[model samples]
Target: MCGIVGYIGKREIKRQLIEGLRELEYRGYDSAGIAVMQNGKIQSFKAVGKLSNLDEKTKNFETEGPGVGIGHTRWATHGKPTELNAHPHMGEYSYVVHNGIIENYREIKAMLEADGVTFLSQTDTEVIVHLFEKEIERHSDLFSAFKATIDQLDGAYAVLLITQKAPDTIFFARKGSPMIIGRNRQGEVFFASSDAPLIGEAEEVAYMEDGTIGYATPDLIHSEPDALQFVSLSGDKLTAQKGGYRFFMEKEIYEQYQVMGDTMIGRVLDDDIVFEELGKTFLEGISRIKLCACGTSYHAALTSSYLFERQAKMPVNVEIASEFRYKEPLLTSDTLFIVISQSGETADTLEALKMAKKAGLKTLAICNVDNSSIVRLADATILTRAGIEKGVASTKAFATQVMVLWMLSIFFAKKRATLDNHTVKEELRFMSYVPKVLQKALDVHEKCKRLSKRYLHGHGFFFIGRDIFFPLALEGALKLKEISYLHAEGYPAGEMKHGPIALADAELFTIALMPKTLLYEKTKSNVEELSARDSTILSISPEMFELADDFILTHPHKHPMLEFFEMMVVEQLLAMEISIRLGNDVDMPRNLAKSVTVE
Candidate 1:
C-alpha cells in the first residue's frame, strides 16, 4: 500500500504536504515525492527512501501564493524503489500521485508507447498522467479528460491529479482503495488516504466512496450531494501517540488492557451481551456462520471458530478471503457470512463480502474502521474500538476481535438455550475480570525481554499449541516473522510428528503454549518429543516444565479463556522485544503496510 495526500488551500503547499505524508508514514513506503502548482506551473521534488529524505529535499525550495499540490509515499509494486519510480509522475501536462495497483497498466503503457509518448519512469502510475495528457488532447475540459482517463483504467486506485490547465483545482478518484476529503473553517480543502492526517487539521470530513470521481478547490469540493456524507470532527482526536513507549507495537501491546475494556463497555451489561448494531432479529434465521478474512484477521477468525462451535454449539466454516471468491464457494440462505478486517478496506475480504451479499446471505462485519468499505457493504457491523493501530504488525486489533467474538459466542448460546442462565452469568462475570488479567500478563515483559536475547540467533522458530491455542500459536509465529524478519511456522502440537519434527534441532527454537486448563499434559508430551530432538524449548504455562530450557509462568485461572488472553500478551511482548533487540523497525516493518487495500 502507498499513501497519498493533496491540498487545495491558501497555505504554503510544500510544508503542508510533507507533514501530511509524515502522518501516513505508518502505511509503509520506500520512496516519496510531491508536485505543487506554483506560478501557473507544476514544480516537483522527488526523493528515494523515507519521508525524512523528501523533507530534506524540499527544505530549501520556496513557493508563494495560494497553491494546490499532491504528495505520495510509495511502496514499490510496479517497479523498484528509486527516484525515477517514485510518485508525482509527470506527463506533458499533468502531475499525478497514486496508490493501489493498475492491473491493465501494461496494455495502456504499450498503447501510449506506440503513440510516440516518451515515458520517464517505470511505474504504472506514470500511465495515468500520460493517459490524461492524451485525453486532454481529445477534450479541452480538464475534469472531462480526467474522467475519461479513469474510465479506461482497471483495478484498485486512489489517484490525485493536478494540471497547469486548472492550477487551483485537484482532481481525484477512488476505486478499491480509501480516500478522505476534509475542509477547515477557512474553506481550505485537504485529501489523505486516511483520517490520521486530517483529524486535527480539518473541522469536518467525508470518506470518498468507491467509484467516486470528484474535484476540490479552495472554495468548495465538487461531488454529487448524495455521494458525500460529511461528519463533524469536533470531538474526535487522533489516538496514535506512543505516549512513553519506544514503539507503537509496544504501546499497543500494553494498551490491550484498556482497549479490551473499551470493546466490551456498552456490549456487556448486567450479565447480558447486547449488540445494538445487530437488530433484535439479527440471528433469527442464521444456522451456520462462514467467517472470511485475510492475514491477522484470518487468525482471529480461526480463534473465534472454536468458541462459536463449542460455546454456542453453532457450525462454523473459516475461509481465507483471498481464496474464497476464486473457488466459487457455495452460499446458503441460513449461513451468516462474517468478514473481519482491521482497516475494513482489505480488498479480498471486501470482495468476498460482496459475493456473499450477491448470494443473498446475511452479512456482518467485524472491523476497527467505522465507515470503511466492508462496514458499509455489510448488513451490520461491530466496531473493534482499538483506536488507531499505527503498527504494521497488529496487536490490539486481534485482542479486541477475539474479545468481541467470545462475547458473541456466549450471546448465541444464551439465546439458543444451549447454556443455562447460571452458566451464562458465570461466563459474563469472568469476562469482567479480563482487563485485570491482561494487566497481570504485562508483568512478564522483563522476562520476555531477557528471553529474546537468547532467541536472536536461532535457525528458525516453531510456535506450537493445541486446540484453541493452535490459532494463538499461528498469531505468535506471524508476529515474530512480520517484525523480526525471521523464518517461523506455527503447527498443531500433535501434527509435529507427522513431518515437521525432522526440522527440530538444537538451533531451532520451539515456543510452546501449554495452558493448564485444556490438553496441557498432551501438549507437554509433544514439547518433550521436540526436546528429545535437541530443539531449544521455551515453554509458557501456569506450571513450570522441568524439560524446558526457559519458562515464563502464567497464573493459573479457572477458565481456559483467561489463560488464552494471558498467553496472548506473552506472545505479543516476546515478538516485539525480539524485533526491538534486533534493531528492526517494529512499527513499520519491511514489505508490510498497516492496511492492505490492494490484492
Candidate 2:
C-alpha cells in the first residue's frame, strides 16, 4: 500500500526516489521520508503530509547525492502516518525501509530491547533497522546482516537496507509485496517497489518474484530467489512510470485505447470471440456463472452480469465478495466462478475464491497482475494486460477488466446459442469504436470542471437508473462520495416513490444514468419526478432528457451493450474533477488506500 525506491548507483538518489513517490502516492500516505548514506554517515529526512512536504524539506540541502539510499511514501497500516512513522528507519549504524506488515515485530522488538536496542518510533518498520544493527555485530558483512535480519522477520515485507559501512551497496528483499530491479549497460543498478524509479536512466528490468532478494551495486543487480530457478529479464521502458503525463490517471485514461487495443489484439472473429487460454471443455461443462469482486471490480461485475444474462442467456450472479462469502452461496459442481481483481491479491476476494474451490466448483480468475497468488491458486486465469496503476483510484485497470468480462460473455454466448454468431461478431466490431468515444469524453473536461464547481455543495446527490444501469448509478454516486466529500445516493428509477422521493427537493442534485435503451421510459419519468420537486438534474444519457430543466450533457454514444463503459468513464472523470475543485487531494483521498492489503 506504499511506494518504495532504493538506489546504489553513481547518480543522485533523492530525485529518483521523489519521482517514484509521486507515482506511488495513489497507494495512500500521510507522510514521506528518505535516507541516504553519504560522507560516512546515514542522513535521513522526513516530513508529515504529502510527498511535497519532504520535497520542500530537502530542496535547500545538497541533493547532489552519489551514494546508497532508500525512500518511502507510507500507507500507515501499523501506526498513524506521521514523520515518526514514515519509513527509512535508522539505527546506530544501519538505515532501513520497508512495505507490507511486519506481523511478528513486537516479539522481535522485545527481544531487541532486552539487548539494549533503544526504541525511537511506534512503528513495526523501525524494528528492521534495529535488528539489522544487531545482526551486523554478529555477521559484520552487509549481505549476511540482511540475511539474518530477514530470517527473523516473520511477516510480509519488501525491505531496502543500507549503512555507512556499505556506502556503495543497497540490500533489498521481498516476501509478499512487489519489488523489481533494473540494470544498465554501464553497470548502474537500482531497486524499487516497482520499476518506477529507472524510467529514463534504466528501462531494463527484472521483476523480482515473491521471496526474492536483490543486492544493488554500482555495476550489477544480483538477484536471488528464496526458492528455486532463474527468471527471464527484459528492458521494458526507459521510464516505467507514466511516460510523460503529469498524473498517472491522465496517462492511464489515455492508455485505455492502447490497453483495449492489446486486449482485443487477435481474439476477434467473423462470427464469434474465442479466449485462447480457456479450453472449450471448460465452457462446455459450465452451467450458471458467479462473478465475485469488491469496489470498482464489483461494479464491473454488475455490468458483466447484464452481458451474460442478455447475450449468453446465462444466469449470472454478480455478488460482492465480502457478502458472498458469508452466504456460502448455493453452488453446483458445474458452476463456473469468475473472480475479478486488478491486483489479483484482494483479501476478501481471494478468501471467497478459496471457499468456492472447497465447494468443488470450477474457477477462473480475471486479474491484471500476472502469476499472483490468486492467479496461481485459481483453476485458470484471464490476464488483463493493463500495466501498473499507481493511482489510488483505479482507472485503466477497471476499464480493461470490464472489457475482458464483456469479451468473455460474448464468447460464452456464442457457444451457448443465446446470441447468433453474427450478433456476437457485430458486438466485437462495435468495441473497436471505444477509443474515439473515450477521446471525445476527455474533450468535455471544461464542462465537468464547471459542473463540479457549480453543484459542488449539494447536500445529497441522487442518481437514478433502471435495470442493470442502476448499478452504474450506484457506482457513480459511490465514486463521488468517496473522493469528492459529497453525500450522494443512487436509486432504481422506479423506486423513487418507495422512500427516496421525500428527499428529492430543490436542494438535492440528482443525476440520471439513462441511455437510449428499453428502460429509457422509466428513467425519463424519474427525471420528471425530480424536475417536479425542483431538484437540480444532471442527466447522463446519449441524448439529453428534455423533462429535467437542468444543465444537459450527453456522454459519448455507444451501442446499448457498450454504453455502461462510457457511463463509468463519465462518472470516474466527474468524481476526480469534483475532488480537485473542492481542493481535496484527488490521488490520495482521506481514509483510503489504493489497495486494502490488511483488514
Candidate 3:
C-alpha cells in the first residue's frame, strides 16, 4: 500500500509534509514525492528511492508557506519504482496522490491517451489525474470534480487532489483504502493515508468513512453527514520531541503500552466490552461463517475457528485468501464471510472478498485501517483501534484482531444462548487487564534477544502445540520465516508421529506454546515427545515452567478465552527480536512486500 499526506496551512508545507513522511516511513514505499501549490502554480519534487532522495532534491527550495500541498510514498503496483513512475503526479492541470489499485485503470488510461493527453508516467494514479482534468473541464469546483471523478472510478482508491483552479483546497475522497482527517492547534486540517503521519502534529483524529468526500482547509472542513464531526486537537508534547529511541519501529515497539490502552480506550465501560456499535447483524446473520485471511491474519482466523466452535457452538471455516478464491468452495446465500487484513488492501484478500460477494453472501470485515476496500464492500465492520502498525511483522494488530474475534464470538454465543452471562463478564474483565501482562514480556526482551542465535543458524526449528495453540504455532513459524532467515515448521502436537517427528533431532530447537487450560498437562506431556528426539525445548506458559533450554512466563490470572492472543503476541515479539539479531532488515524482509498487491 502507498502512503499519502496533505497540509493546508501557513506553516512551511514542504517541512511539514517531509516531517510527516518520516513519521510514516514504515508503510513501505519505493519512491517518495511532494507537491505544493505556491503563487497559483504547482511546485513538485519526487525521488525514485528513499525519502532522503527527496530531502536532497528539495534542499535548494525555500520553506515558504501560505499554500496547500499533498505528498506521497509509493509502492509500485502498476509500474516500476522509477523516477518517471513515482507519485505526486501532475496532469498539466492537477496534482494527485493515491493509495489503492484501480482495477480497471488500464482501460481508462487507453481512453485518456486517445484524447491527446501526453502521459508522463505508467501508473494508475496518472489515469485518475487525467480523468479528473477531463471531469474538471465540465465541473470546476473541487468537490464537484471529485464527486464526478469518484462516480467514474472502478476499484479501491483513496485520492487527495489539488489543482491550479482550486490550489487552496484538497478534494479528498475514499471509495476504498484508508484516508483520515486530523485537526491541529491552529484548527488546521490534515489528511493522510494513515494516522502515523498526523499523530504528533494533529490531536483530534477522525477516520474517514466509506463513500465520503471532504473539503479541507487549515481551519475549515465539510464532510458527508455520516462522517465524524470536526473535532479540535493538539500533539503529544513528549513524543513530538524525539524520545531518544534509535528508530520509529523501536519507539513503536515500546509504544505497545499506549496501543493497548487505545485499543481498550472507551470501548470498555463499566466492566462491559461493547465494541462501540459494530452492527451485530454481522454476527447474527451468519447461518455459516467463512473467515478469509492471509499471513498473520490467517493464523489469527485459525485460532478464531477453535474459539467459535468451542465457545459459540458455531461451525467456522478458516481459509487463506489466496487459496480460498480459486478452490471449489461449497457456498450458500446464508453464509457470512469475514475478512481480516491489517491494511485492508491485500490484493488476494480483496479479490476473495469480491468473489464471496458475487456469491451473494453477506460479508463483514475486521480491519485496523478504516475505509479500506474490504471495509467498503462489507455489510458491516468491527474496527481494531491499533493505529498504524508500521512494523512489517505485525505484533499489536494481530493481538487486537484476535481480541476482537474473541469478544465477537462471546457476544454472538451469548446472543444464541450458547455462553452463560458469567462467562462473558469474566472474559471482558480479563481482556481489560492484559496490558499489564503484556508489559511483563518486555522484561524478558533481553532473554529473547539472546535466544536468537540458536534459531539464526537453525537448519530447522519446530513449533508444537495443540487446540488453540495450534494456530499460535503456525503463526510463530510464519513470523520467524517472514522476518528472519530460518527454516521452521509448525504442527499440531498430536501430529508429530505422522512425519514431523522423523525430522526432529538433537540440533532441532522446539518451542511449545503451553497454557493453563483444559489441555495444559496434555500439552506439557507432548513436550516430552520432542525432548525424546534429543531436541532442545523452549516452553512459554503460565501453567508450568519446567527446566528446559528456555522458558518464558505469563501472569497467573490468564483469561481462558483471551490467552491465545497473548501467546501469539509473545511468539511474534520473539520472532522479531530474532529477526533483527540476524542482521535482517526486520521491517522490510527480503523477497517480500508488506502487502502482496500483485496477485
Candidate 4:
C-alpha cells in the first residue's frame, strides 16, 4: 500500500503537501515526492527515503502563486526503492501520483514504446501519465480524456493527476483502493488515501466510492451523482492525539483499559450477558460451532476455542480462513459458522463466509467496521466497537475481540445450564475488575523497557504457554515479528520437547507464560527444560519471581480469563518497547498492510 495527498488552493502548496505526507507516511515510506505548478509550468521533486528526505529536497522551492499539487509516499510495488522510481511521474501534459497496482501495465508500456513515447522510470505509474497524454490529444475536454484513460487500465488504483492545460484543477479516480476528498472553509480541496492527513486540515470530508471519477478546483467540483456529499472529519474515530506519549502504539497500549470498558458498555449487566444483535432463536439447533479467520484474528479465534469448549461445553472447530475454503468441509444445518475480522473486508474470510452461506448454514460475523461487506453478508453480526485501529500490528482490536468471545461463551454456558447462577455472578464480578488489572499492567512500562533491552541482540526468541494462554503466546510472537523483524516461535508447553526443544541454546531467549493456573506446574517444568539447555528465560508470572533468569511481575488474579487478559496487555507493551528500542517503526511495519483486501 502507498499514500497519496493532493491540494488545490491559494496557499503555499509545498508546505501543505509535505505536512500531509508526513501524516500519511504510515501507509508507505519507501520514497516520497511531489509535483506543483508554478508560473504556468509543472515542477516535480522526489527522494528515495522517508518523507524527511523529500521535505529537505523541497525546502528551497518557490510555491507562492495559486498553487496546486499532488504528492506520494510509495511502498515500492513494481520497482526497487530508488529516487527514479518515486512517484509524481511527469509526461508531456500531466504529472501523476498513484496508489495501487496496474495489472496490464506491461502491455500498455509495449504499445507506448512502439509509438515513440520514451519512458523515464521503472514504475507502472509512468504508464498512466503517458496514456493520459495520448487521450488528451484525441479528446477536447479534460474530463472526457481522463475517463478514457481510466477505461484502458486494469487493476486497483486511486490516481491523482494535474495537467499543464488545467493547472488549477486536480483530477482523480478510484476503483478498489481508498481515497477521501476533504474541503476546508476557504474553498480549498484536499485529497488523501485516508483521513489521517485531513484530520486537522479540513472540517468536511467525503469518501470516493468504487468506480468513481471526479475533479476539484478552487470554486467547484463535479463527479458521479451523490459522490460529493461530505461528512464531518471528526466522526468518533480513535485517531486522537498521543496524549504525552512518544508514539501512537504507546498511547494505544495504555488505551486497552478504556477499550475494555467501551466493549462491555451495555452488553455486560449485573448477572447475564445480552447480545441484542442476535435474537433468542439465533442459536437454535446449533450443535457445533466453526470459527474461521487469519493472522491476528485467527489467534483470537484459537483463544475462543478454549473458552467455548470448556465453559459452554460446545464442540468448537477453528480453521485458517485461507485453508478452510479449499477443503470440502462436511457441513450440516446444525453447523453455526462464525467469521472474525477487524476490517471486515479480509478477502479469505469473506470468501469463507460466502461458502458457508451457500451450504445452508447460518453465519455470524464479529467485526470492527459496521458496514463492511462481511458484516452485511452475514445473517447476524456483533460489532467489536474497538473504533479505528491505525497501527498495522493490531492492539485494541485483539483485546476487544477477546472480550466479545467471552460474552458469547457466557451466554452459551447459561443457555445450556453448563454454568450455574452463582458461577455466572462470580465470572461477571471478575470481568468487571479487568479494567483495573489492565491499568496495573500499564504501570509496568518502565520494567518492560528494562527487560526488553536485554533481548535486542538475541539470535532468536521462543514463547511457550498452556491452555488458553497458548494462543496469547502465539499473539506475542506474532506482534514481535511483525514490528521488530525478529525470528520468533510460539508453541504449546508440552510440545516443546517434541520439536522446538532442539533449537533451545544460549543464543535463544525463551519467554514463559506461567500464570499460576491449573497448568502452572506443567508450564514451569517446560521453563526448566529450556534452562537446562542454557537458554535465557524471562518468566512472566504473578508470584513465581525467582524461577527464571528474568521476571515480569504481574498482579495476582484467581480468575483465568482475567489473568490472560492482563498478560495480553503486557505482551503488547513488550513487543512495542522492544521495537522502539531497536529503532524500527512500531506503528507501521514493513511490507504489511492494515487491511488485506487484495489477498
Best by lDDT: 1
Candidate 3: regions farther than 4 A off = 1-250, 280-285, 543-547
Q: What is the lDDT of residue 65 in candidate 1?
A: 77
Cα TM-score per model: 0.62, 0.61, 0.62, 0.62
lDDT of each: 0.88, 0.76, 0.76, 0.85
lDDT of 3 by residue, 458-553 (tens): 468788889878888988888888888788888898888778888777678888888787488787777877787778888887755564678877
Greater-lDDT candidate between 2 and 4: 4
Question: Lowest summed lDDT over 10 consecutive residues: which window, candidate 2?
Answer: 227-236
Error of 1 at 539 (Å): 0.4
**For each candidate, how many residue pairs have backbone atoms clashing (under 3 Å)?**
0, 4, 1, 0
Clashes of 2: 4
What is the lDDT for 138 in model 1? 98
Ten-residue segment with the worst summed lDDT in candidate 1?
A: 235-244
Error of 2 at 395 (Å): 2.0
Q: Candidate 2: TM-score?
A: 0.61
* Tens-place lDDT digits, model 2, residues 187-210: 666667655556665646666667
lDDT for model 1 comes to 0.88
Measured with C-alpha atoms, the lDDT of residue 547 in candidate 3 is 43
Give the worst 10-residue stretch by lDDT in candidate 4.
235-244
**RMSD values, in order shown:** 16.7, 15.8, 13.5, 16.8
